[model samples]
Target chain A: MSRLSRFLKDNGISVVFGVGFLLSLIGQAFAGRAEFNEELQSDGARPVGFFEYVATSHFAVDITENWQSEYLQFFLFLFGTVWLLQRGSPESKEMHKAGLESDKDQRVGPHAREDSPRWAAVGGLRQTLYSRSLGIVMLTAFLGSWLAQSISGAAALSEERLRGLQEPVPWASYLLSADFWSRTLQNWQSELLAVGSMAIFAVYLRQRGSPESKPVGASHDATGIEG
Target chain B: MRTIARLAVLTLVVGVPLTGCAVPQDRLEAVRKATERFATLHTAGDFRAACALLTSAAREEAVHNGGPTCAQALADAELPEPGAIRSTDVYGRQARVELATDTYFLTSFPGGWRISAAGCTPREGRPYRCLLKGD
Candidate 1:
């Protein structure tokens, strides 16, 4: 394959998602600006420019809220699947393979293959950290995004309060307020529902080539089977 | 992958505070001065001067609320003394200056900060009921 074709094949998933993210973000900006301007007009305020709208807490909160929820969903899935078993679901490990398996099964330390990661090969705090790195990373992303959402949401809500000639609460107060929890829980509930449904659906569903689903010919009772 | 993750974490850490509750010192000072100027003009009974320092919407609303002109309406309203500025909270173009006796709301235009409301009293779980609120 040509270099371009090779690069495309190698990085197709990332590229596709990245492009989709950009397009969706751009579309959101335009739509949000229009909606914002309409409100501004009704409120006797001047319409903001596209760039200015993008920089506002309104846009920041909306983006970060969604991001935090997605990361939270992934974080829960990553950690939960390690301990919780969903029988016959392609998304889960085999029924007998619950909990952290043996060192031999994991191929760490003495059992580490040459191709294994350096941290995995070594036995120490590094190995312990590397063992749970995926969960750690997901948790970190979720926390970071959630914090971002809170900060930006507070700012946005404060502006609205100010517009209404009300007292703008401090960031700390906002974090503790119902507005913050409402925004967080609303997104979180939807994300959790999607994840739970996906897990349950995969038990009976089949996708011909997708690794997320069991093979078309795979038995419904076959656990941990992926295409 | 590690580098990307680190960058994302760093961005979130830094971007949150930068994007959140950032009112520039200079802008705050400017808003403070504008509030002081409005108070001075209004307290001195120079209603025209005070009216001049109001947002166009506010001026229109002031006129519509009371007398035929903005100044006439403001003079008729008999706004109370604002006293010293206790605190100020600014969010984007809108700012609230809390005085010893009352609160005033200001909005920034291309020229400078203009009074949007004054002699504002808080209503529970609602927008402040301002004596001279903008439309």
Candidate 2:
């Protein structure tokens, strides 16, 4: 019991992310396969096996479009925090604080009393970049998902032509079509609405002890920090 | 007196039509009827019967393409019941009729009209593209 508890305590975040990813992927496979078969049966077409279906871009676009939007939300949030502030909201920094805080305030460089990360002290551009490293990683992930969407969307388009007993359109043309944009924008809208609403709502709402919200006792006008 | 009056009315109706020449059946009406019959068979999941109604050229093409025997092909299909005509759109010799599970694009054949293609289901994993035929 103790060993399991210790392992979970030390690796809870990793475990959560890993399991969530696995379940999400499994869900995509099942739903996508069912929808695919339904369409095939309607057209007097053959149904593809699971692994083969996964290899096609139809699945790729289905997954990547959502992934890109999620990463974009986090990336935007990370960078937006730098200059944007909402008074009394735990999501933002103080109203007037802008750019990176001081090294001493951040507990690194010459201000380190010895427990500081080795890289934090070995400063210059490395330290400068690390200051906003969260944003960088999120932005990189967002770009990756976007690229995956385009590649998969093209493959899906070609498959459609083949089924129609017509010549397949090239990947380049598919990328520019209304179908692709419509799918992308539809997903993007939902993500944007969620993020935008949460940012504004956190200003007035309070959840005791939760880092996502200010403490109930905190003043309604408080700009940053957990109340 | 009643018998005479009834006979006079019957003669009036029969004589009016025969007086000149009989009216012709509109070509559009004949075409529409054929299309309706085609859609009815398809929606009932009777692909063989439906294929039998096709023009000879289409039947040849289906066989040449290595498609399943018509009955076998229909076994996996999902369709509305027979006698339901969702919609019918005609353009001269070509027409498109949307049934519950299939949208058939047909051409005027010697027998009447035969389906050139059915556009209903999208390609597997590619829901945006309609799959009309076997890959």
Candidates 1 onward: DockQ, in order: 0.66, 0.01
Poorly placed runs, candidate 2 (over 4 Å):
B1-135
What are the Cα lDDT values of the candidates?
0.89, 0.63
How close is candidate 1 at the interface, in terms of C-alpha RMSD after superposing the true interface residues? 1.4
Query: How many backbone clashes are present in model 1?
Result: 0
- Residue runs of model 1 more than 4 Å from their true location after superposition: B1-5
Each candidate: chain B TM-score: 0.89, 0.49
Q: Per-residue lDDT for A1-227 in model 2, tens only?
A: 69999998898987899789879888889899889879756755446678866655567678778877888889988887878777767788887786777777787778866877676787798877876677886786677666667655655664554444333454477668887798788888998799878877888888787888888877778878674
- Candidate number of the best DockQ: 1
Count of clashes, each model: 0, 5
lDDT of 1 by residue, A35-125 (tens): 9889889889878999989888888888889888998999999889888988889999999888999999999999999999999999999
